[model samples]
Target: MELTQRIKQRLREVEDWNVVRDELETEAASHADKSEQSRALYDLARACESVFLDKAHAMTCYQQAFKCDQSNLTALRHAREIYQEMAHLEMVARLMGLELARNTDASIQPSLSYDFGMAMLNQRKIDEAKSHLEAAQSLEPSNERYSDRFQEVLYDRGKWQLGLENVMVQLRALTGSDDPLGSDVVKRGHPLSALFLRAARILQQESPDDPKLLPCLFKSLDADPSNDEAGYLAETILGNGGHLQHVQKLQDRRIANTDAPEAKLALMLAAANVWHVRLNKPEMADYFYHQALDLAFNEAIVDVGWGSDWFLAAYRRLAQGADESGNADSLVPLAERGMSMLGEVDCSILALSAGELAWKKFKDVDTARRFFSRAAKLAPDHPQVVAFRRAEGLDDEAKTTKLPAMAPEAEVLTRELPVADDDDAVDVRVDETPRRSTFVDPASAAEPEPTRTPEVDAEPEASPEPEPEPEPEPEPEPELDVEVE
Candidate 1:
């Protein structure tokens, strides 16, 4: 990387600035190796910034140097410092983010994440900051800088009271978040649900009857219904405090606030689980399962992963419910419909349960065999299926059950989905993880039929009493005659 003689003479003493700049630009553009090109660009940037005083052009040159060779951290660092000195924090963050995107080094990742989170927080980009700061703190939990920064965000936003400061100290030990009680958290509620959940878990353990336990727990859930474990814990809380009604309100509020079908489905499954297991209202669980399918089925048809995950959850939960549910006559078909739509999954539990119910309850051997075969197709080596296969004396090579595929061309799903209006029940998705899928329809009449707003009749309405109309006519005639007189 020796300099050319002509450039070397200029380096010893600048005779003409233009000639030195031109030679450097030429070298940067024509260098065959990226490292050499980056080196040339770095030198060019330095000359432009120091001598020509072209900060903008110098910034571009440094960026280009970094682009040419990421190993040139000096170039990026220079660019970042220049932007920072000029009070362009956003640009500084952008450069930091680029470095992070490469995942070039694990050692500096926490620092970069912490710095990036701070920049975003300063910009009032709470959601973006939430992940990065949380990650930085998690990665370097011992680092007070990272931990304090993240906790500060939650506290400033949470606006906790003095009485709660001790609680906060305890919570920070358990988990570094407050009640997440601000309008800001209310709007997006990130870390809101996570924090609320942590608090709920703590309360459940220490003060199961605390008035705030269920609210905090449900709020945590409504923020992210993806976790499904609220069932048993909720049962415990509700059973102790009997604040089931409060949970109901939260569930309705969450359903009304969110429009994402997946979110709605999560709520539905949560409620269904609560009703099926805790409240022992199997009918209600059946209703919610139907509602969840109606809400999420079409989404499953279209979405690749997330919405479909919710659908599968509702399906599997309903299928599990079907075993003990008094409304199995109706619930089983709804679960089957979801299984058919999913086409195939790694787990066959739903299909296996469906087969068991079909044989033991419905007494339909053929349909039961079909379901069993489908279950076998999903997991040919599953122990349960193997044991069942041996008992049934089925062939080793059972033909795969090919249920009707959720046809991509199936009638554009116009199903009226309808979660709750004014009910006061908390629905906690059971442990399958407020696990994610999107799922549909029941075969039995026990399923509540979709409500239809019938078209209004065009015919004029008749008087409740025709005789009353005649009396009014007589009275009007008598009044008219009196006026004429």
Candidate 2:
């Protein structure tokens, strides 16, 4: 059943392929030995491929050859090549899995594992694909294909949906003139956009001064325009890098263009800072700040950092403006909003400012006291609180929000005590408090009313001048002598 090299070489002639294929098939069927039958069938499959150009028949022959003799995994490889040429990845994986299960060859396992991983990935078996891909990379660390594909899988495998979308993006990019993408993709969690974001961050970390950083960041946002973090990052970079004009254009294009709350909230904060901090256009800043804050307060968006630094900064500016203008009607709501997000501000100062605004702007003394109390509670020992409390009394339930721990004696008085008789009540209360002696200053004492020292009596009082006391004689001479001794 074995075909010699001479016959195989002759079989390469296309004109005689049908004759040779028929002869090989006859020989394979005649073999009683399975190994002999496998060899003859392999020759027949090759004739079918190279001679007849019949891939389907070639694949059938290859599979039959492998089944006849498991020792010839070459048959499976030939079948796999056909499946791969047809782009039938499921079949390729199935064939490869079978070959690896049966073959113990170490030299080819890495390539096999790699191919299998790719097939699994296309099949949407993410975690399994990762393992196989990782194994291939581990086995052959020098192979960049193995390692790079493995990393690509790592980038998105944490979420299967994202990984699947990422793969789809990759596939689509190859299938047409360009990638299938748009503004709405970010709202749907576009994975290509996420990958671009990671690349931009790496570029920023590795080469902060590189000119490519801005473009990379822009590309990420372009891939997913509604990405809040990417939008804010680009805004910050553009703003701080003296590209304020470009930043304005970027915000103008992104802000009102998308209905995404996160996009608007984050971008608005950035816009506010541009107007408020860089340009000193408070009127414009006020609009953007209110836009961001309204969304933030209404819980329409999550933390876009409003940026990492901008969220807190925006509120601070608003509060400062309110205090400086001396006319903000929403001062109470501002304080409440600021205090609610405690970590975003120097809360004691914010509360203190609100209290000042309430008192100075609107003469809202009670509201001022309420905020002052909160300020004191947040920072019990703030110098401003101390000075205010010392200079002016805020006496009421709202005077103090919190106090230091009571001293031991004071603590004892605060505890409830059993009632006692009226006589014992006085004693019990007095015993708990320290006794004190009262003193009166002569200057402060009321003088007795001048009675009828009438007109006639005033003249008679001149005789009383004899009441002046005589000077006492000195006994100092005797005392001095004893001291000297």
Candidate 3:
């Protein structure tokens, strides 16, 4: 053939390998005969591999060569090599599977089947991996690696089956179904739930605004509420207000269930979000927000295992609600309670809020200073903390005022009580007689009393002195007179 001669002549030329590859590719395109084209493409692929080291391009050429001639073992081997090096395990598995299917030779089938099985294992195609691996083991019972890989596949398959059983159980729980046969179907584990969740996640990542994703996410969550990814998708759904009726139905069901605190919290958060964002009813939103936070806090406190982190998250939601409602006054108490309840937890927002409220709303400079100082301690580099400190001149030293000293007379006077001694005692007597009248009645006060009293008193005054003692002794002798007296 002219093309083959031209290809040989071009290969012998002193031209660059790239030029030779281009000429061969041109020759390959020009040829109408499948055999000639296959030879030219194969040569071109070799040129690309040796000179350019472009395995991907060479693989393409080898694929074309194999399509032109199915008996092209070189093309198959080179393509398989390139795929293996690229870690295209799925492609290698497919290629080897096809080779095994086409080849009737038992010896070559065992090697190809083993390679296919290994590739399938790498691709996580466990069932196919198991089948081909078992076949290889049967063909060459002495191959330990094939047995090991097969055992691994069997172990993975068992785990996969168990996971599917769990998913089915969750599905039945969500749907409130009593189908006994559902377990049988999922006992071997179909990948439906995982596949659906994966697809939903892909949709969320690729086309978030696509209308179809909401239902997918909702289904994922409905199947398993414990799925954190599904929960996030639910949040996104709620945020967009995409399915209010369904959300409301879920909320109603969760609210009716008194025993499920976590479910109730989730529903409460959802309701709060709906009210705050969609309905624009901040008061109602605040009510639900507080309810959810209260529930979470109670659950955490009762050792229900809803850790302190959950309580802190609830507190943050409450704070967010307060902020959204424009209730700065509420933030004061919230910040205080948050600090007390979340001890040692970083509460910079609460501290900043408390400081701002103290400064602006309460107008208490000292309280504001204390709160701002706390905020600074918590987050010194926070913008609000820095701004507040700068605005209040906290970075500056305080000016001191001195008062003049008091004079001696201006000093405070203190009285001291005299102490009493045990031996020191005093007694005093008082007169009870009434005082004489200073004025006399002129008609009634005659002078007759003065003369008779002076006559009786004068005799005693003259006789008095020495005889008085003897006379007293003589009078003592008269017992009768003394007794009568």
Candidate 4:
């Protein structure tokens, strides 16, 4: 019997969809044509979905429908929707590809192609996504979303050079305007900064020292000076002499014009490099370094990988110079300031050095012990910390007792006793007598030896004169005189 005729007859026999559904299922089981079976299953799925609201049964029916007839658009659409919602992006992309192949009308091609491309993109199918997105953009050139998505795909595929070219095109359009800052591109999205940053990153990776990268970095900084990456790249380029004079001039101008803390900080840092490297002014260099450090603590300077290390090193140099000059007073303050700038963990070695200087030169055991203890807290088992602890008598084996001063006459003594010879058979008995203490009273002991002063010790020792030669032995000069005569 025809499946439709059976469904109709069953519908007339009973107004219940359950009866019609059961009859259709029986007929579908025995149906000869796969198409008829697919229709029956699809109808049953609709009935289950609309009447019973059973998504699982509807999904099963849709799958069966698609299996029976590959051309079943409705079934494919429903199944694809479910898969998409389930985040089965690969399956969604495949189904969309099939749908696109089925639909050939130009009116619907753009939407279908875009959907397929987005699905592929979600699945990380970059090449396929780019192809489809490009097609969609060409079909509808005015679609901003398509253009944006295509650009994203290009970037994802590591086509940074192409991305940079597109960015340059946009930048040119904006900069060509009478008021670039008020241009639509800037008002909509200052993609200029992001593009510059991306281009800079690509160039940096490809050839860090390339001259072209300097312009990109500078453009990025111009777009947004607060950009940490741009600042870092600019600093690196200028430091390496990439447009050094021009960048320094611009930085100086920006510093003079802008009161923004981040800008000032970056500019001051660059100025410091200029002073130290180009101008050869140590005083100005130190001044800028300190200014940058101060600004960093108070302001939100973007961390361009210059955090505390530079200042800490400068402080160390100063402290070391002072220590070498035997100016303990100056060394302590510098080291202490450095320790405060950098945490205890990073500056523990500085602390140890200061402790040693304090103890050895200043004889300030308390200060030395305090510094050592702080260092121990940071690195308990450090070699220097352990050595300092032991040297300061703070170790486990250290004794607390203090011995009294020795007496003046309590000196070391050496004596030898003679032994009897065994050759003579005679009695040789020697009496054993106890020795008396040789220590003398303090009042009777000679005056304590005077301590030697450096000036006195600096004097040269005196030496005896050389012996005079004998007059007769003074070479016979008379021999030559007699010959001349």
Candidate 5:
């Protein structure tokens, strides 16, 4: 192409710049003012620089252009863009600060605020980040992207050290966070039920009705089916073993899915608990108990507080079962293993329960008392231990008062009479005179005239003859008549 034609084409491409420049030049020449021409030249320069990808150069030109002509919208827009590109965020922030001060466009300020928030985020100024981000979000509520970013910042803030409420707030801001297996869901605390459910979901993918998942849910349900966290637990149990077997089929169809370690653990626990505590299937219980213990072993470091308890319980049960069946050798190692997992606090409770069980069921009072005493020492204020002590006292009292067995006749006599007076009652002598037993017709009886009865009455001879008595009443009547006269 010829040079002239190329120039023409270039000129045509920037027609707005040329036209504006020409008009400004004409006006300046007419007015004989160098300032207008200079300003026009600056505007032309800014227009040419707008094509440059170098944001810095474009920004400088735009600022110069605007100084020359304050009403330059192109310069204003280009300057804003360059301010946005300035990698020295502090400087970019200052420029935004200037824009905010001007308050030129209410709509643009919110966006500017959002950009500042992002800049703050890049600098890791969290408080400032949240402040600016929230301001931006408030102004432009329709911009979910900004809201999401703000919530993401909050989520990161609560990774470990922050309180659970803080973490949950951020989680709720994200959709579907209520579902454990949902993409944005984060487990902030020891929400065992949710954790179990998440594992179950993962397991479900492996085998729709994996028997593995059933036991996990069943144990939780049995322990407390009404627990909100255990909602899916029930479903998983049904899937694995309950009527429909729908989950099983789903799992069978997708058997290639991987088993989640957590889910497997949960399932094992559920199964073992049900088999041991519910169904009393020792073999089944042992199989899952060991599996659960193994899983707990892996999780101990991450979830030590509760995981340790679970592991210890499973190991203890398994060992006890083995020991009771004459497999003391196998039981020894398990007991040792569980003991290792036991923390001081938990050990106290376990010891106490063990002692009580031994005593109450087996009448090993000495052992039980030792256990109760240890438990009291472990938790002096524990209500249960205190109650146990009260019960122990009552039991002792009961034993002390236990009476000896008496002869059949004595037993019958003692039982027949309601105790009228405990102290007043006399113990019948072995060889006492025989007393005649008497009874009265309760309905037709009248009080007997107070009188002495003969010790022996043979046939009452004829109607009792009136007892002969001397009459001496006449003298007393004569003396009373004389006194009245």
Candidate 6:
């Protein structure tokens, strides 16, 4: 019998769903030797729930069909949509996690698994969430999102748990030295070396009460503060009862010793992020924000012809941080300064930020609209600007504008910007580009070091020196004697 006809016949024979369900089950079982045919029968049975006049019966059949072929993408997608609308949230997480696990590429797994783990986490299935996230992380060991979440799961247990300590030890071992974040030392070259440092930071958080670990953690941060690990570690230490004196002393030392503007920028940013998030010290956060802006401004002015992405990035971070903390007054000046630095460049993002700051933080929609208008003009096609314009119920009269890329001729214009007399004597050559070198692997046994090689013995050749004049030797002693007198 056709699958649809069979389901219809069962529906006619029994008013009770149990009888209808049992009849459908028998039909499905008869086709069990043909898995594909059985799956089709199950699907047809599940589909009957809509017309069968029983909602609960439909759900059970749908679930059973899904169980027969867990890899059925079509069934999974439809089920998700229904469950999401019905608010049947329990199974959604497990299904999403399983689907992501089926992906073959390891690089992409972490992002997918992270989403799955988060859903499970929200459902309060902590153990399952940790397992899925760990599996994702194992596939992509360097991914920050997976590793960070996995550590967070470990942290949900008590602070003194040995499991957390063991993870820390494992991370520290990968670092490859006594250094808290071993191979993560800046010497590693890749930006992601910071991952190890972040792992170390998580360890510090797990052992917040241990005074012995606090200094070591800070010491490790001192070595590679630019990475996210240092920022995260610093935040945890500052927030969770570590000595503030230690943080300040270490920061001060870093600021004094490192002449690299990028390093200073990283330190300032880390300080700002840490104080704002962890300490709830808005005033301190503002201080670091101001410092970071000042440093970024100097870099832009010094290298105006180059990319200002770093400075722009810093500004965005500061603005976002301020917005989150409800510090509107602090955001305005910073945003304005950023706008000025940006000049005729597409200043739309800044405008949107200003509008947000005004409307949300200061409760001034009129001022916000004006800023939004400018942003709309600057970037009419931008999604954020368009959204804001719509929110204000503004008409769509705005037109997109094109801006010029930084031309090479702008170098002369940039050079015209004033430089301080006391600034470092290092020559600012427009032609000289910054060096970016990759890490060289250490020598293997097959590649012996020069010191390890036997030196060839050869006769030494020497040249005789001419006789030295002695007359000037007496005059030095005579001058010293006269000074004593």
Top-scoring candidate (TM-score): 6
Q: After superposition, how far is residue 51 of candidate 1 from its true place, in Å?
A: 64
What does the lDDT come to for candidate 2?
0.53
lDDT by residue for model 4 (335-397), tens: 554343344343455566666667766888766665555555444555555666677655654
Query: Model 3, stretches more than 4 Å misplaced?
Result: 1-15, 28-32, 154-485
Task: List TM-scores for all candidates, in order.
Answer: 0.33, 0.33, 0.29, 0.28, 0.27, 0.34
Off by over 4 Å in 4: 1-33, 46-53, 101-107, 140-148, 154-485
**Per-residue alpha-carbon lDDT of candidate 6 for residues 62-180, written as tens digits (9 for 90 to 100):** 45555666555445444543443232345566456456655565555666676677566645466677877898788888976577667657654564456545645655665565544
Tens-digit lDDT track of model 2 for 153-226: 66543454454455446635633435433223323344656655554544443345655456545555655566
- By summed lDDT, which 10 consecutive residues of candidate 3 come out lowest? 476-485
| Residue pair clashes in candidate 4 | none
Model 3 alpha-carbon miss at residue 38, Å: 1.6
Q: What is the C-alpha lDDT of each candidate?
A: 0.51, 0.53, 0.47, 0.50, 0.40, 0.47
Encode model 5's per-residue lDDT on 174-270: one tens digit a residue: 3334632233222232233333433333333333355444443332232232332333334324322322222222222121121444454555554
Give the Å shift of residue 76 in candidate 1: 34
Which sections of candidate 6 miss by over 4 Å?
Answer: 1-109, 112-130, 141-208, 242-260, 301-342, 345-485
Among the numbered candidates, top lDDT falls to 2
Candidates 1 and 5, the one with greater TM-score: 1
lDDT tens string, model 3, 113-230?
7788767654445566678888888888887545544544443333554543454465466445554222222211223333335444444444455554555444444444434334
- Sort the candidates on lDDT, descending order: 2, 1, 4, 3, 6, 5
What would you estimate as the lDDT of candidate 5?
Answer: 0.40
Report the C-alpha displacement of residue 234, candidate 4, in angstroms: 35
Residue-by-residue lDDT tens digits, candidate 1, 1-485? 13433332343233234667776787787999989999989977876654443455667788888878877877886787566434355776777776677657788889888878866764547568879999999999998557655664554334334324544454444433443332123334445555555555444444455667665655555565543334334544443343433334444455555666656666666665555434444455565666766554434332322222334334444555654444456545544444433434412445565666677678776666555556554455544455555566553444342322312211222131121221211122222322233222232334434321112222111111122111111111100001110
